[model samples]
Target: MRLAPGRAILTLDLALKLALVVLLLLAVVFPDWEQFEGKAIGTRILTYPLSGLLVPAGWWLFFRGRPYPFAADVVVILPFVIDTAGNAANLYNSIWWWDDANHFVNWGLLTAAFLLVVRPLRLSWWNLLTLGIGFGAATAIAWEVLEYFAFIRNSPELETAYTDTLGDLVLGLCGSTAASGLMAVGYQHRELPARS
Candidate 1:
């Protein structure tokens, strides 16, 4: 059976959040779990529940009155689930490039979600693309800075990794571009109706 759009997102969002709770339980109960090692207390708290929660909270507080959140919102939250799962399953360092993949994909989803939420603007296609790219770049930079201050500064290895920062920014750029293209195609095809 087909579910309503909003119901589907709510279900998926709830399931993912519950999964994170389970992952957090594992992390706390079995500190020796390979995935739990080397994770700072602040980092775990931020990544596991706090940061991961803001998307749904933002949706409920700001966007729930709409017919439903754009599917892109659900897409936006998918990365949190993926990232949390990777960490909980010990895949971050185990599988090389996992972090990089997350950065690329998450930024793309976020960019898309932002555009969808603000689609009422009726901006020119060019302007929308510019907005998405700018938003993605700014977010990536902000995240990198947060990482630096929150956890990276304490670790000598992360402090020296300028290339990773640059790489992440590049990925964000690419992701934003991709999201813009996706939105553009949707608008062009009339899949996304302009508000008002």
Candidate 2:
């Protein structure tokens, strides 16, 4: 029997994660000494995941007729959207990549992810705060690792690698913090206890 779109998405998402593990091997390219600057790291990190997600996401968007689980919707959508756009900007680094704009863009996205996750997780105020910070930091580190070693690994002139990685972490934190704050405030008025 044919799988439903939702099921197909789940399968595809998992497959993408696995595929990422494989493509990570390509990270050890011959180094370029220059141009490995900060925020540029964010650009690199965003590339594969965005591309990995886009095809399946696009397919699902067309095939699925029913509404998604709320948390699932946010989890799936925002990352794909922001990452795709951000990485696209990276393609034209000589043209489209803007640092300040990228920071705010990522911050906005991470915040959205954090808030969305909180509602679904039904995190308490304290947990929400912890998760936001924790998630932000974790993703930032992972993204940096990917940037420094993976796609841009061959660059010898990585002046901004560390700086950009730092910026991405900061922006991610801002996003996560914003999300947790929204969740905490929203929970105060909400009667539903989203306990798992």
Candidate 3:
């Protein structure tokens, strides 16, 4: 049968969260798992649980008594799921385009989640676009810095790291700009909440 849209989204969010949990457990329990090694395992151990915490954190911070933001939660959780799964499957190395796609799509997902969470604020189009893109760009830069310090500094990947970092940043900006622009346009006609 079919599920309602919110229910379906909730289901998907739960499933993704479950997958992350399983990945986290594997990382902790079997740090030598064939699918991940060295820094990869450490990354998973650090990232997975933190990724899972975002939804509840957002709820506690922003959506306390309101309806659960399942769709927003999915948007927030999906990129981490995709990244972790890709690593587990070794797709980032095997599929030449996977990393590129992740850079673009994950940034888009993050920006979209930010917009969704803030929708009730009824900000103007310009404000939404600015904040969304700013958040995305800042995150993209932070992620690159993390990579540099975490693993890329000493790895063979450092040889092409400059170019790769530039491209990833550009892709992330494009993705976020696109998502923010679209969201701004869509919300342009809605009246902003009146200031007191």
Candidate 4:
């Protein structure tokens, strides 16, 4: 049997969310797991579930009784899943470019998700660009702050933290800008909602 497009996307989204939960649980249960050794398990345990719930919560809060945008849900949940999976697989250590790519791609995913969530607002292209980039920049800064406190502050990685943080922030903002530009252009013609 074949699922409808929305159903298929929703299925994928649910799968990613489940993977995220399982990964978190494994990290908690086996703190000695390769990636768990020097990582921020506590912060992840607290935040990952909340991050996973964001799309569902937004749907309930903003579009109750309407079909939640499954594609958007997948987009929003993917970054968290990818991040967790990367850590679980030890890609960040085994692969030199994993961390950099994660920052860039995750920010792009986040900015795209933000655009999709606010589409009902019928905001102008410029407004979308401004808001999306601003949101991405803000989140990147917040993430760096969290990283500093969670691991960098006391870790041997502290020596290179400054350069790494700066690079991550720049890559994240670039990703956000690229996603915002694509989304803005795609929606330029439909900036205003049609009258009934």
List TM-scores for all candidates, in order: 0.81, 0.54, 0.87, 0.92
Model 3: per-residue lDDT, tens digit, 1-196? Answer: 9998877887898899999777667667766766566355686667666876787898898779787777788888889888887877778768999989999999999999889888877798999999999999999999999888888897788889999999999999998998899889889856556569
| Candidate 1 lDDT by residue in tens digits, 1-196 | 9989677778887776777767667667777776766556446655657645565577677767655554654666666667667888788879888878888888888898888766766776777778888888898899888777776666765755688788988987888788887877667667457689
Candidate 3 regions off by >4 Å? 24-35, 189-196
RMSD of each: 3.8, 9.3, 3.8, 2.9
What is the clash count for each candidate, in the order shown?
Answer: 0, 14, 0, 0
Query: Could you tell me which 10 consecutive residues in candidate 3 have the lowest summed lDDT?
Result: 32-41
Could you tell me the lDDT of residue 80 within candidate 2?
Answer: 44
**Candidate maximizing TM-score:** 4
Candidate 2 residues lying further than 4 Å off, grouped into runs, are: 1-68, 89-100, 107-111, 118-121, 191-196
Cα deviation at 34, candidate 4, in Å, is 2.2
lDDT, candidates in the order shown? 0.74, 0.54, 0.84, 0.89
lDDT by residue (tens digit), candidate 2, 42-141:
4444564664454346446653453444334445444544443443335325544455455545555565554553354466766766666677667667
Worst 10 residues of 1 by lDDT: 66-75
